[model samples]
Target: MGLFDRKIPFKYLLMGIIFLIVIVLVLTGIWMSYVNSSDNLRENAYRLRTMTESYIENSFQLIDAGLKLYDTAYNHDMQEAFAVVMAEYNGTGGDPSRMDLEALKTAIGGMDVYVINESCVIEYSTVPADRGLDFAVIYPDFCIYLHEIRNTSGFYPDRVVRDWSTGTLTKYSYMPTSDHHYILELGLQSEYFEGERKQPSYSVIVDEARAFNPYLEEVLLFQKQKRLIGNKTYVPTPEDHAMLDYILWENRTSQEVRDTGQERTVFWEVIDLRDPDYAADMSIFAKLTYNDALLSQELARLGVLHAFAGLLLLFFGALVVIMVSRELSRPIEQLVNDVNSVASGDLDHAIRPVSGYEFSSLAESIQVMVDRLKEQIRKCEINEKRFMDLVQFLPQGVFEADAEGNITYANRAAFDLFGYTQEDLERGMNILEALAPEDHTRAKETFMAVLQGKKTEGSEYSGVKKDGSTFPIIIYNTARMVKDGTITGS
Candidate 1:
């Protein structure tokens, strides 16, 4: 009753609402986690795509430049000049002196040359021993092309294979001649083509030697090849080669060939750049990884917040339930205490009203009933004392009888006259029983006459007491009547 009784039900209703809200929050949190994970994966994919596109574009640029440089070096004017130098060296029986070698080297040096040939045989080079090397034995295809140009007089401006005796990647551009074909093979180190930027993970530049062989073996041997070319000598490192072997096989199917040379195909792969184990050092991948890490952190933080909020709500709900339950039970507790007091004969005790209107009304009603019961008990005490005083004043023996001939009341005079107390005048004895046998019949006739509203005057009666003594008396009898003319007693 009070605010507590009315609002306690609402509190339970609110608790049910809060429970539903918490369920919704949990569902939303799960959905958000899924969305965040999907977004992270999508961002990683985007980063990988961007990195791959950049790598491919850069590769195309490098290939175009290299091809253009090859074409420039194989022009007609350059071929004619190389052919003139080759005819002179062959006319001299292939024995080029130091002065002749220097002049030939100077002529090819105009094109930033590394090697020069006379009569399809190397006669001069930036490195001294490169002269007097047979080009046909080192590169049969170039030699065959030179022989074809000598016969048909056509210019060959295509990529050709050449021996890398100098232990470097060499760019060879040939000019054929009739007498002594001059072959200019420029040793362009891989470093020159690599530019300022470093290669990304899973990208490789393969030239002729790598293209002819299986890519799986080449990728496996990449470190070994790098060391061999960098040091300009072969020094086998088995552990390094073994380490490269596992990933090399994994790359065979994933990689795409960018360019094909005479003996090699440059292969590269567009792997997930955001993979931390592989692309940890890349800036783009690092940023993507950071984004995913941030999302994870956010999800964890939200979970903690949700848990804290739920705990707080639960605590508040428990507190509210305790307060509301106590408030609702207070009135019932008061009612029980009041009833116990009344049962123990403490009728003076009264119920104290609390907040509820119903409790107040019940308390008032209980007090009223207790007051009426006390008044009735006081009136009964007064009547009993008055009756005892009246008995002391009566001189004649008087006995009261009900209409059924049972003695109902006996005064002190009557008790002394009959040698009996009021206790002996109970239902077991009547006036007729107290009379002597001879007077019993006369007593009944006179009593009946009086009961029938006829007064009996000077009736003679003899009675006996409980002590076995007998006496004679003259009795006057009359009928007792209520105001409504009904006989009450005789």
Candidate 2:
């Protein structure tokens, strides 16, 4: 058989299909994982944004409440009453003694009020004098209000002031008293709105003074934002920045620029604490920042772990594919090589089975086929030798012919008897050509009768050689056949 006739085993084909299926499954799983992760990221971002918005809104409400309180206390009637009291005390040429001061303190205590004279001197305060000794110096803009009051009669300024104290932004409303040449500054405590609740990390009050001189000593002079106790700016680290940015980008509203060149945008909305019509709003930006920082750290850790696991899985999958292909292909490759060797005429070679049951069965079948082929070849050799020996004894130019009357085999005696050489017999010389013209007719008749299966008695015939020699021959003809039983003429 030709080399092209070799067949591949079923196992190899099955293993290839399995390997393909595994690869497709692995790829599909990875794709699904990627899609899930992306969805999780989007969901996390949206949640963070909502949280930040709520926090910002709460902060805005707190500030708004403080401003409304200042407005309530700075009414025109209150300012006129305070001016009349100051005029009575000044006109009497009275020394504002401790008893008088104590009574004045009692009157203003409920409103958390402070009084400054035309000279920018703080004459009375609800708190002790020492506690507010340099109050005018610390807030020079309050002195300006006193000057404006002294210059104008029955005038009330709609302006307010911000005092940054102990890292807290306090708001105060000022009312001008031209009759007494004084300005009444009403101050509120940070805890007044919330009623002693825990305050936020930072608070910024927007008032008229702050609007004019936005640069406060605590906000501008301190390079660092220290944790309430000292002046220090909070310098975020790289990781902190990443977390903050993630949260802000995810949560905060778009940027908005004001006429003052400042970007003070509302990041969130909540109930307005100062307005009874709306709910309290507060900014928990610091809390949101901390959450974002934590999330960023966790996400980074998860990413690293995912990358490591993916690499490990990739290595494991590759190893599995390689090992499986090698284990399965090795035996099949060997079988193919063995079949090629057999087809190339190496019948003596034996096929060795490997470990698999299928390979073992295939090897046994091939061995049986080889053994049968070898036995058949040996029998053919023996028959050919026997035929040659028999032909050696033939006389009267005896030769084998097929049903077509074409000579199949011619021995040396037959050649000598017919005066023909080996070349003439090998060239398939016609039986008619081998006979003389007179004997050709008789030779044809005898061959025709033999082809019909009739036994022919001894007949005389003339045979010719390659050298044109002719000789008389006597033929005792009978039917012959191939070893397989097909008929031949003789």
TM-score of 1: 0.35
lDDT score for residue 133 of model 1: 67
lDDT tens digits, residue span 1-490, model 2: 7533556464556555666777677667765775577568647655655544444455555644555555455456456545544654566454333225445534654444556665676667655542345535643543544564556555343322223434443444465553555555555444453332224323333222123332211121111121211233455556445433443435443331122223222221213232222111122233221123334455566666666666677667767876787787788788878989998999998887777898889988998999999999999899989988887876535677777778877778877766677776777767777778998778888888887778889888766766778666677778886688656566
Residue 119, model 2: lDDT of: 63
Report per-prediction Cα RMSD to one decimal: 16.3, 13.3
The true-structure Cα RMSD of candidate 2 reads: 13.3
Model 2 clash number:
18
lDDT of 1 by residue, 1-490 (tens): 6645664544455555565666676557656765676677557644654554455445545643454454355455455555655555566765434235446645654432333354566655656666676747754544555555554333344332223454433344444334334444433233443332223222353233223322223432232122332233555456434433333334322343322223233233322222121101111110001123333455567667656765665666666655765666677668768867876888778766766888778877887887887787678789978977887678987777767667887778888888887566653677777778998777778778888888668877777888978888777777888879988768
Maximum-TM-score candidate: 2
Query: Model 2 — TM-score against the truth?
Result: 0.45
Model 2: residue 397 alpha-carbon error in angstroms: 5.1
